[model samples]
Target: MSPFLTFKTFYTNPLNIEYFYIFLFTFLLALSLIAITYISGKIIKADKTHMAAMLLGCVFPNSGNYGAPVALFAFGAMAFDYAVIIMVIHAFLINSIGIFIASFGSEKSTTAREAMQRVIRMPVLYGALLGVLFQLLHFKLPPTIMEGISLVASATIPTVMLILGMQLAEIKPQLFALRYVNSVTVIRMVISPLLAALFVIFMPVSDTLKSVYILLAAMPVAANTTMLAIQFDVKPNLVSFTTFVTTLLSLLTIPLTIYILNMM
Candidate 1:
């Protein structure tokens, strides 16, 4: 419940210093996956929309609803703080870098100014910054206010899942037959996690934090990819398909990954 305690330990304790590296690793791993997928799509002579779809799918993971709960279950509530940090990094990256890539890769020509505007318009980064500021400053709110915040936060996951379902309903039937679908799936559900595992091995964090990282790595494509794709007109159907497929695939992969990590 006291994430500030974990954040404090992260800075003051030598053994926990790797917590800073976790943010770097998560951001770099995501960028690396996006780069790999984008290049692979180019090498394969994929179309603009398909390549954009690859960016959307491979660059982001469902770190919130899917990753948080899995971390809570596998590593308990303490690890949930690590998951929150990962998700915060994930959100910032998705809002800025993710949007830029999706916009640039799309069929339309996006200027740097436009991209900058899109990134600035996103509130996640500001929210994350304010949250950390409050934690660092030991700012306390009333219990009644905290309770209301908790109540609203509890609805986030289900609301995201509902949005995903609605996005699926918007997918055209023809996109299902696209040949690039398998490639997107492979990049998202397979290669991304493998890259994350390498980071996990090298990270100096505790075993529980390592487990949280790996589990978050194995999560499905971000459900928000669909919304971003739709917003940027960046091959929404393919993005939605990859989101749906990767999420369905994770039902098997995530649990199996948890068991494997335990055995390791």
Candidate 2:
């Protein structure tokens, strides 16, 4: 069978519904982490390092590179609209919440203007805008251009995953046990996604929207979080470790999430 057919069959299969429910459960777990972050911030008095790590963990996802392809593989063109919307939201959160957290307790803080500029300049933002514009205009890329984009974009996931693995190899296992690191992982990988899913479930969203929200929520922590941590002088190691932990954990969480959502 063709890949598209296989993708369709998988979604339609009775077993797949179980996967969907798992997605829902994981998303709820993620929301719980967000609450933890807020309460922790208040109780612990918002230490710069801890706050930054928590923020980095909570915001951003391996969406553009990892998510788009996975959506395409599992749901084909049917999933495109949902994927695009989630990507837009992801970009916004990274620029706003992610930036705020990274800047906390830092001497060289970014102003609103700087943050806006950074968001505007992000390639993901431009790519998503262009994708939506093209869809709205009903403009089609040349076969060659489409093929090229797909080929280049396809490399993004594996390249990112490999880099992430290498980075993870460098982490001292001890860091994983740190209070801040553990807190960030629980929030980023579990709480944030859950909140996003709950929003999707209650809102009058279409199935496409529901699927996209769940998929985006299930994504592991973005590698960019660590880069931002380094640039902003917010505990890069903590960010990296959180990324590693969440990404590794997502192997179980993501598949289960998809299963559960399918059932629901």
What is each predicted model's overall lDDT from 0 to 1? 0.73, 0.63
Q: TM-score: which candidate is best?
A: 1
Over the full model, what C-alpha lDDT does candidate 2 score relative to the true structure?
0.63
Q: Write the per-residue lDDT of candidate 1 for residues 69-164, one digit (tens) a residue.
A: 678778886777687678867877887787777777676666778767866775555555556566666677677866655665555546655665
Error of 2 at 250 (Å): 1.4
Where does model 1 exceed 4 Å of error?
1-19, 161-179
The lowest-lDDT stretch of 10 consecutive residues in candidate 1 is 1-10
- Per-residue alpha-carbon lDDT of candidate 2 for residues 190-252, written as tens digits (9 for 90 to 100): 776677676676655457657767777778778777778888888777777777778789888
Q: Model 1, residue 112: displacement in angstroms?
A: 2.9
TM-score list, all predictions: 0.83, 0.73
Worst 10 residues of 2 by lDDT: 1-10
